[model samples]
Target: MRTVDKTYVIKGKPETQWLLVDATDQNLGRLATKIAAYLLGKHKPTYTPGVPMGDYVVVINASRVRVHESRPETKIYYRHSMYPGGLKAISLRDMLQKHPDRVIRQAVWGMLPKNKLGRRLIKRLKIYAGQEHPHQAQNPQPVA
Candidate 1:
């Protein structure tokens, strides 16, 4: 049964807003999944597929996000520069120490659609390693 809703026929774009999430002492994966949902607009009743209906998410205290004890030593992030022997790896502990924001970003990315729309949606997310964010002027509402 295919039901067409007039609301899904967006003319250009839909209303969007900024949301705030605190990552202090929160689990890395869990926090990321929550953020991904907001970025995908799954939290909204007006969500439409293949549309950039998500809201902007501002995450603070990224450096304080945590993971399981074993993961710090066992988890290894990998990347390649496209050249032979360009493979590189970094442990979770090292990643957190150097680029905490990337940790959350990658985690959330893994949960996204992995397409052009996904790329655009990711841009709407803002992350900060510290507690202070310049989005204070937006007066972003705290996510539950």
Candidate 2:
């Protein structure tokens, strides 16, 4: 009897592609989760653990991302400046109005691995408050 090995291995560098996501009328959590997956290469068959095999993600209309109807006023995001009495809290409504990009960025950031790899993956995410983005040259494919 002869034993044969048939496992396939991915070599060379990973080909990074640009992905576009529209946040219009989409649930905040769901959209972020999908974006996070793409950032971590979880959607690819060649996924490798501890490897940043993901692609770039461009999010447009981030200001339109949907949250619970009543969450805007009740939901609070907190931040600390590492100093006494430095804790600050902002409501979802305010956050959306002031920095819509941060809303999605923070959401996706939470879903990625808490390590250097995660940091690198996050840098690929580009967000826009409207439907205009500068990555048109990359011809990013629209994603749900």
Candidate 3:
């Protein structure tokens, strides 16, 4: 009887990549989806469902991200407290001003998996309010 090997081989080194995305005048939902894909390694051929093989994403000018139609007023972000009558809601306009980065981050976060690996992938995302960021040392490639 001859023994055969059936183990799968995993090749290639996982290098840390830095990517920059300009959010100026970009649609919120569309941009978030792209960012989430990059953070989850969905754009790579070697992507594994449960592995953290994503890249670092730096989003600039998050304050300029836009939403279509009356979403600014109609869209409501909800939050609740453990106590009764503690439900809270805020409009998209308010959210953009108060926590601009959070708006985009939350959008992208929702598109990712609801697991430990997803949490780790989120750590690679960086959102900035202005055009300038502190990741210049990483030489992030500009996504055009």
Candidate 4:
């Protein structure tokens, strides 16, 4: 008799959880990495690739996320339209003032898989500029 190893595959929907994170005074890169891990479900032992086994992450006070003092001036975000002379640029300080939620979103997005799965995973991340969020009904546990 020949023994063969069978790969373990998760059947049905994998269990998921809701995690709440407070961004107050949290480092931007560190916070984004943690959020990306939870969104990718790497924190779970049953993590399976190509499966949407991640958690619903709710981040509050995104505006309070911190970075190095010089980062605001040195870091510049840029985007260019397909058309000529259509480039747009914004500084980190300006981005924080305009869209604080995007700061965290873009950072975390960079850490996720840039594919269909990545798109779907990003939807589970809910970011709020202030301390309040509407996901309280989900009874999400604080993830520290």
Candidate 5:
């Protein structure tokens, strides 16, 4: 008979890997979904939702991310300043032109758990508008 260690448990301090993803020409929703999964360690066999088990994700060419809509301008991102009549809305086109990185960041953020832990997990994501990034020291592998 084989004996197994029932009390054995893995810690949240899993070995983190660096993943490089090119956002160029990729659909916004699809790319965000994949990145969110990676951030939450969903791809790992030892994934525990309560534990912060994930890797660093570096995204490049975020400015070139595409949308499925024929007119992406119809998409709206809303925000509130928590003041009287502080509601504001920004179109996708404007967001892409003004701050492209925010587009991907917001998308991934929404997919993550809405809690303090989620906020901490999101910090692992690094987004760049262009192809250049300073995380080359990590030698991140291309995420296909």
Candidate 6:
């Protein structure tokens, strides 16, 4: 009989990478799903649930992300202030126009875990409204 090892092995030297994704004409949900997967290290063979071993993701052309149907008008993002009557709501259309990068960033953020490690993972995400981003030095590989 062969014995199996079930202990968690920590990688001594993890190779981190930079990936660039173009959001032009891409569906919002679909793009978000892919970005979340990369941020969570799901695409890596040595994935560990509690470890922050994900690669850096840079999304360009976030302003061009598309939404299906009437969601642009029907979807409302709500927020409440600490004040007694500070509940505020904004339509998806407004949010996209006002802060294009935020729209996709929030979607991807929602897909990540709600913990400290998740917060750290999100820091590696960089969303740009246009094609020009300052991370050119990282030489991110384009995703097909």
| Candidate of highest TM-score | 4
RMSD of each: 2.3, 2.7, 3.3, 1.7, 3.3, 1.8
Model 4 segments beyond 4 Å from truth? 1-6
- C-alpha lDDT (0 to 100) for residue 33 of candidate 1: 93
Error of 5 at 44 (Å): 1.1
TM-score of every model?
0.91, 0.91, 0.88, 0.93, 0.89, 0.93
* Model 1, global lDDT: 0.92
Candidate 1, residues 1-144: lDDT per residue as tens digits? Answer: 998866565677788899999999899988999999999988888888888888999999999997999999999999999999999999999999999999999999999998999999999999999999999888898997
Which TM-score value belongs to model 1? 0.91
RMSD of 1: 2.3
Clashes of each: 0, 0, 0, 0, 0, 0
lDDT of 4 by residue, 1-144 (tens): 999987667989888889999999999999999999999998988888878889999999999999999999999999999799999999999999999999999999999999999999999999999989998889999997
Model 2 over residues 1-144: C-alpha lDDT tens digits?
999975544688898999999999999999999999999998999988788889999999999999998999998999999999999999999999999999999999999999999999999999999989999999999886
lDDT of 6 by residue, 1-144 (tens): 999978565568667899999999999999999999999888988888888878999999999999987899898888899899999999999998898998998899899999999899999999999999999899999996
Task: Show where candidate 5 strays beyond 4 Å.
Answer: 1-9
Q: Least lDDT summed over 10 consecutive residues: which range in candidate 5?
A: 5-14
